[model samples]
Each structure stands twice: as structure tokens, then as C-alpha cells.
Target chain A: MKTNNGSSRAYSITSILILIILAILFLFPLYWILTGALKTPAAINSAVPQWWPQEFTLRNFEVLFSKRSAPLFEIGSLTGPIIPGAIRWLINTVFMAVLAMLLTCITASLAGYALAKKRFAGRVILFSLIVAAMALPKQVILIPLIKEMSALGLYDNLWAVILPTVGWPFGVFLMKQFAESIPGEMLEAARIDGAGELRTFITVVYPMIKPGVGALAIFTFISSWNDYFLQLIMLTSSSNLTISLGIATMQAENSTDYGLIMAGAALAAVPIIIVFLIFQKYFTKGITMGAVKG
Target chain B: MDKTLSPKLRRQENISGYLFLLPSLVFFLAFVVYPMVMCIWTSFTDANMNSNTADHFIFLDNYIELWKDPVFLKALVNTLIIVFVSVPIVCIFSLWVASVIHKMKEGPLSFFRIVFYLPVVTGSVAVTVVWKWMYNNYYGIFNYVLKSTGVIDKNINWLGDSKFALWCIIIILLTTSVGQPIVLYVSALSNVDHSLVEASQVDGATNTQVFWRICWPQIMPTTLYILVITTINSFQCFALIQLLTSGGPNYATETVMYYIYYTAFKLYRFGYGNAMGVILAIFIAILSAVQFRLAKEK
Candidate 1:
């Protein structure tokens, strides 16, 4: 028994040591990006790489901003002020992500509540369809969607990106997972009190499922912001590019500009990372909750 | 309550339910279902970007040609390799990490969780570009570290060489892939019934035995989920390939997802791309079903 305890203690220590090493491995790339972004060109391009930036400079970021310019946004004949293309791309990314999150939350909660509580004719079928749709490789639909969006005259619009993201049933599936946990007794009580559908949902269901919505909101925002393929295929014009697409295009133009690319990478990654950090709790819940009985 | 509801009450329920569903259904149907239907339909016809030539019904030709096409074959094999390799690695790696870290206190646990998950939240483009630079033939950190440590004698072209390119992409895929599974497994492990574990311990079961007997079965659903998602995500690893390799160095890293994008957008063979899409969907469905069945039997 003493030997067993001794071996087990050794085993745990070894495991923890290995875990820290692996954590550093996983973290090195982000550390590389941040430091690489600040490192001067000579430090960036040296034979022996700088583990940390020796010569810190904002020249990379300055060059990135100076690379191009675009009107901030367009509204029919009226256009917003001109800005650095990188900043415009960030703005576009925010618009796309926020709008997608908002629409997804609103639509998903309503549908998810109905699926959980309503004994409608097609509830089972619709719920199944939503789950099944969540499985389909989202990129597979990009081709047909391009044709469809073009037909609707929204091929280059941010709504083109936002609408499809909202259309994907992941948010609804996740929300339904949350909605199922709302006790039937609560819904029954609300109905018994002569609360109408909208009123009960607004007053009761919304409050109860707020955590789930919070999870979905952050999740949606991050995914939409980083949805590079959809943005690449759908948004062709430079002015319409999201930050991810913008960086991708920028890299294609100047492939070996490590410092410039890292600057763009920092621009693209940092804000979303900040968002993820703030909503870490809700986001974790969203991921794990959706996998329950999945 | 549902069974006892009167016809009038059921009717009201249906009305209210459908009304609630209407907004979501509109977006789902228009954006998802319609495109899906169009994709399947287009796969049967000879569609392209030529405005003068209307697409003709040419069923099975695209699917048949896909089997004969060498690049498609290579792509299919590469995608399967990615899915098969990365799925298990992700599952095992994450489950192991979760087991160790889930025992930690809140501060350390959250730190590990966030650290593992940062790659994913870093945005794929950011992740891809940085990886591209690090894998640069001349100035990459990998070569620098290896050479300094007497591992390799010279700088190796990580993405430019056919032999190393696929594995390079897979390594990046592993970093981004483990995040969600780790999150899921952590949640699953911590939520395992503690009383049962303590009882098993009192009966003198070892930690491994306790984990296998008490925790594993309870966490099987999460395992199945991780498997399916990792498979899907691995199968759809396009951004890294696009940004880093573009399936070059003689198509060594050509994946079906990237090929589909190439076929439809780059090559303008919409029908062929859609055909490949259909085949991919079928593979995912069958694999997911097989996983579900296996998990059930266990």
C-alpha cells in the first residue's frame, strides 16, 4: 500500500510537469504573434530568432495601416469617412459578428422555447432537422449559397454573411438544449396565470435562458469574426473584407512580410480574444451544455 | 399534460408554437435548406460559369469522374488521413489533459482551459498566418530551435516540401482542434458523480480502474460528441491549407474541402464541386452513425 501511494504520487507529479510543458507548446504561437508583431524587421528576419522582441517598434503596424485605405462604410449615396483599410476591416468584422450574434440569439431562443414546450405537429421533425442541419459541412453550402445570394442581390453584402450564419441551426440547437432544462412546471404556471405566448416568453423564458443566450452570443461573435472561408468566398471586394479575410488577402500580396502579417494577426486576434476572455464562463457552458445527451 | 390537452388547447399550442418558430424557420429555410437542395440538384447537372451554356442533366458523370480523377483521389485520401489521425489524437489528448486539470482548483483550471482554448479564439486567419511565418524555410523558429539543438543540419522548407507540408498543417490543426474537446472533457470529468467514485475507492479500486469503471461510461456521450466534431472540423481544415500551402508542393496536402473550393470557385466546375460536397456529407453521416453505434455497444 505504501509503494502504491508512492508510485501514484510520482505519477501525478510527472503528469503535472508534462501538462505545463504542453501548455507552453500550445501557447507559444500566440506569444510568437504578439512579440513578432512588435519586433523590428531585422529581429523578425534574423537567422537566430528573437525569443522576445529586442528592438520593439510600431513600424509594422504603421506599414499595415499605410498599405491601403477605404471608405469606412457605405449607405446608398452616403458614405462614411475614409479610414485605414485595416480599421475598416475590423469595423466590418464587428458589424458582421454583432449582427449575427443578435439575430441568432433572438431567433434561436424563440424557436428553442417552442421546441422544448410546444406539442406542435412538426416539433419533432423540425427539431431533428435543426440538429441534422448542424451536422452538414457548412462550407458545402457556400457554393449554392453564393448562387442563392447572388440571386437575391446580396452577394457582396455583410448581410450575405450574417444571414447564412443565422441560418445555420447551431444556435437553435444549443438554445434548445438550454430550453429543455426549464422546468415544465414553470411554463405551466405561467400559462395558468393567463400569460399569453409573447408575454410568458418575454417575462419568464427570456430571464431563465439568459445564460444560454449569453453563451451563444459570445460563441457566435467569435465564430463569425473568424469565419474566414465564408468571408473569402462571399465578400470579393477589398472594401467589404472582414479582418480575417483582410489579413489573408494581405498575406497573399506580401507573403514573406512576417512583421506586417503578424501586426495584422494581432489586430485580428486580440479583440476576439478579449471578447472570449470576458465571456469565458458563458462560452464554456455553451460548449459543454450542447454536448449533453448529444 | 400534453397527452391530456383538449383539441382546442392543442390547436392553440400549435398556433403559438408555429408563430414562435416562424422567424427562425424563415432564415433556416431560405439560407440553409434552399441552398442544400440547390447543391444536391446542381451536382446532377453540368453547371459552370458560362452564361451562354445552360447546365444540362448529366447524372452520375461527375461522381464517376471523381473516382477516376487522381487529384480528387489524393484529396479524399488526405482528408480521410486528417480526420482519422486528428480525431483520435484530439480525443485522447483532450481527455488526458482534462483528467489532470479538472482536479486543479478554479484558478489553475480556468487558466489551463483558457490557454488551451486561446488558439481557437485567436481567429484561424491569425493562427494560420503566424504558423506560415514560423514554418518559413529560412527564418522559421522551428528550424532555428532544431539547428541550435543539433537536431537538423539545415533549414527545411516546412510548407514548400511535400513530405512535411501535410504534417505541418496537421500540427496546427491539432492546436486549434484540442480546445473544444478539452473544454467538453473538463466539464464531463468534473460532473461525474463523486459519491460513486468515493464508493469505488473504498472498495480498493485503483485510480485507473476507478476512472475506467466510474467516469468513462458517464463521459461516453461527451466522447462521442468530441469524436464527431473533431472529425468534421478536421475534414473541413481549409483555411490553414489555403493560407499556408494552397495544396501545393505537388498536391501532397490536397484535402477534399479545399478541392471543393478550388473546383467551384477557382476552377468554376460547380457541378463537380457539388458532387464532391454530396459525397463528403455522406461520409460524415456514415462516420457519425458508426461512432454513435460503437459508443452505444460499449
Candidate 2:
């Protein structure tokens, strides 16, 4: 019994050490960004890489809010002239992300319900297509997608950015998985009691799958919020740029302002972190839902 | 309920399902499936951006030319390197962390799981910015740690050097950003038949033996899922690279996605870009098909 206790104690100690290391590894980046955001530009770029800032100032934030500075980065093509407005870009990003999330959730829920509950022709083909689409690297369609966008006169527009991503296969797939678990007996009863399919979806199915929708909302929000390339390509005008584009522009305009750049990055990250915290349970449930269903 | 007795009404109820799916189907066909088909067709044509002349079809010309394009070849090499280096490392590290969480009894272990998963929430832009700072040569935290620990005498240029930049980025890739794998592994572990474990223990099998022999086989499907997703993700990787390096130091870090973006947008070579895009689609399709086949076979 004593030997067994000793073995367990050893195991516990090893586990603790591993946990601490992983924690530090995970937390260090956020801590660095927070600290870097707070530091003066000079302090940030200094040779020693100080653990603590010598002087803390909100200068970076002030600069971001200030109108005196020139545009952060050139609009398009490396050789393009600098366009001085960054505020519009940030606003556009916010609008695009929110809109995309709203659209993705509604469509995914509707389609997912159809796929899960109702038997229809080509259902297997549609489901398989969605699964395949989920696995597809976005790079595969980017070039032609761009051309098509241009032809449709939606190129360099926020709609272009939002439209392509709204039909996400993963979202549909997640909703289907969640919807599948909703007991068919309840739906049948709803039908028997005079609830139409859409009405049943709104009242019964939607509430039952709120957890799944919440998870999908968070996922779509994060993906759209973090998206860089599509926005970079589609939003050719600086005034229409997203946060990612704005940050990229900072590199070109003044790569030397490490503090300023880090500040922008922190700002970009705030919404995602907030959403994740609020939906943490949903997020975890979503993963398990996806894994098992797949 | 008797209202549904009519044949027309029955047809309408069935049609509602299709109606509900209409929006997604339209978008999918327009944005996904159509572009996919067009990409293949465009690859064979001498397609250029903003041209008045119709596309001149030159069968297999683009592919033949692409085979010789040093940049495409280099991009392919860089992408493969990221995949081969990052996937196994992330998998092993994630499994180790998951196993650790599995061993712990709820309190600290749950917190550890959250910590490991924190990166998944922070978004790629934040991750990229933080890593860029860490990878900075002279004053970066990474260099400072290495130098202070006496592991190296001087700072090693991480993102600056062509050879080290890709590898440096790979380390960041391997960090296993969210608690995704851990949760999956936990579920998989739970689903394992406890009797099998008990029998092994009764047979005097070591903990490691029980894990390898019983747990591993049970979770093989999850492992394959992770493998496929990670592989596809590695290929799709661009935001972080674009943010940190911008495919800089002479296109050293350019992946196919970045290449396609630049080719189409920056250079305005839309047709050529489409051609490259088709190549990518085929590559991913084949790879994913192979993955599904392998998983099924097992």
C-alpha cells in the first residue's frame, strides 16, 4: 500500500510539472501581446527585450484613434500609393464579420434541419458534397472565385467577402449532426398537432438545437473575424479594408512601430476572445458533436 | 391533420424541405461547384485578366508549364515541408497533453485543458502577431530565452533566414492551438470499453500497454480525422504567413494558397491563377479521397 501511494504521488508530481509548462506556453503569447501593446514604441524595439515595460503609455491607442497619421498601408499591389484612412477598414471588418455570422447560422440551421429530419432526393449526394467541401482547402477555389466575383461586379466589396463564406459546409454539417439527434418522435407529434415544418423548426427544433447554433455562431464569427486573404483580395480599397488588412498595412506603412502593430493585433483579437468566453460550453460541445458525428 | 390528405398538399409538404435548402444550394452551386468546374476549364486556356479576346484553349499547356515553374515547385516543396513537419509534431504533442488531462482528477486538469485550448479562441491574427514578436531576432523572447539558457551563444534569425523561417513557423503551427484534439481524445478515451481496460489490468499489463493495445485502436478513426483536417489546414495556411513574413526573404515561405492569391490579385493573372487553383483542387480531392479510403480500410 505504501509503494502504491508512492507511485501515485510520483505520477501526480509529473502531471503537475507538465501542466505548468503547457500553461506557460499557452499564456506567454497573450501576456507578451498585452505587455507589448502597453509599451512605448522605443521600449518595444529596444535591444534587450525587457520583460516589463520601462514606461507605459496608451500612445499606440491614441495614435490609432488620432487622425494626424498617414494611411497605415498601401491599398493594393505593392507599388500602389498609400491611402491614409484606417478607421473605415476597421468598420468594414466589423460589419462583414457580423453579417457573415448571421447569414451562416440561419442558412446552416435551415439546411441542416432539412438534411437531418426530412428525407429527400439527392440527400446523400448533398450530404457527401458538404463533407467533401468541408475538407476542401479554400485555396482550391480562390482564383476562380476571384474571377467570378469580378465578373459579378462584387469584387472589392464587403458583400463579396461575406457571400463566399456564408455557404460554409462545416456549419451545415454541424447543424445536421445536432439536428439528427433531435428525436423524430417529437417532430412527428408536432406534425400531428398542426405545426408546419417551418413552424416546427422555429418553435421546437431551433430551441432544441440552440446549443449547436450557439457553437456554430462562435465558429463562424471567429473564422470571419480572423479571415485575412479573402478580405485582403476583395477589399482592394483601403476604405473598405478589414482589420486583417489594416494590420497588414501597418507592416508596410511603418513596420518599425512594433508597439502600434501589436496594439492593432490586440484590438483585432478582443471580439474573438469575448465570444469564446461567452460560448465556451457551446464550443466544447460543438467539437465533441463534430467528432462523434464525423 | 386531415388537411394533409390531399395529394397536392402532400407534395407541398415534401417540397418545403427542398425549399428550405434552396438558399444554400444556390450559393453552393454559384460560388463552390461552378468555380470548381470553371477552374479546371480555365487551367487549359491562356486566360489573362481583363482581356477582350476570348480564352485560347491550349490543352495541358498550363500544367506542363507549371511543372517547370520554379516558383510553383518551390511553393509545393514549402507546403509539403510544413505538412510533414507540423502534423506529426502537433499530433504527438496534443495527444500527450490530452493524456495528461486524462490522468488528472478534474480540478487542475480541467484548467490545463482550457489553457491548451486558449489559442483556438484568440484568432489567427493574434497568434501571428504574438509569434512574430517572439520570433524577432535581436530582442525577441525566443532569442532571449535561448541566449539566457546558454543553449546558444547568439540570436538565431528565425523569420529572416529562408531555411529557419519555415521551421520557425512550423513550431508555432505545432503548438496545438485549441483544446480541440484534447476534447476529441477525451471523448474517445471515455468511449473505450472499461472491461477491456480492466481485463488488461487483471492480466498484469502495464498502463502503456493498455493504452497502446486497446485505447489506440479504438481511437484510430478520430486520429484519421485529425490527420486529414490538419493536413488540409496546413495546405490552407496563409494568413499567418502573410501577416508575419508576407512570403518574404524571396518567396521562401510561399504556400500554394499565397501563390494563387498573389498570382490572381497582385499580378492580375486571373487565368493562370485559375489554372493553378485547379491543380490545388485536384490535389486536395485526391489527398482527401486517399485519407477516407485508408480510414475505411482500417
TM-score of chain B of 2: 0.88
Compared with the true structure, what per-residue lDDT tens digits does model 1 show for residues B31-134?
99999999999999999967489999999999999999999999999999999889999999999999999999999999999999999999899999898888
lDDT of 1 at B23: 94
The sequence of per-residue lDDT tens digits that candidate 2 reaches over residues B3-113 is 544777567656987988988788777887787778888888877776587989888887888889899888888888888787777677777777767766776666776
Cα lDDT of model 2 by residue, A1-294, tens digit: 466558867986897797798789788888787888899877888777878888899998777655223343344654433433555566667788889989988998899898987766677888998887776777577677777888899988888889888866788888998898899789888988999878998998999888999888877877787777777777776566777677777766776677887787777776667777777777777887876654
Q: How many angstroms is residue A234 displaced in model 2 relative to the true structure, after the best TM-score fit? A: 1.0
Worst 10 residues of 1 chain B by lDDT: B45-54
Worst 10 residues of 1 chain A by lDDT: A285-294
lDDT of 1 at B259: 97
- DockQ of the two-chain complex in candidate 1: 0.88
- Chain A TM-score for each of the predictions: 0.98, 0.89
> Which lDDT value does model 2 have at A253?
76
Please give the distance, in angstroms, between residue B122's alpha carbon in candidate 2 and its true position after superposition.
Answer: 2.2
Q: What's the TM-score of every candidate structure? A: 0.98, 0.91
Least well predicted 10-residue stretch by lDDT in candidate 2 chain A? A66-75
- Interface RMSD values for the candidates, listed in order? 0.7, 2.5
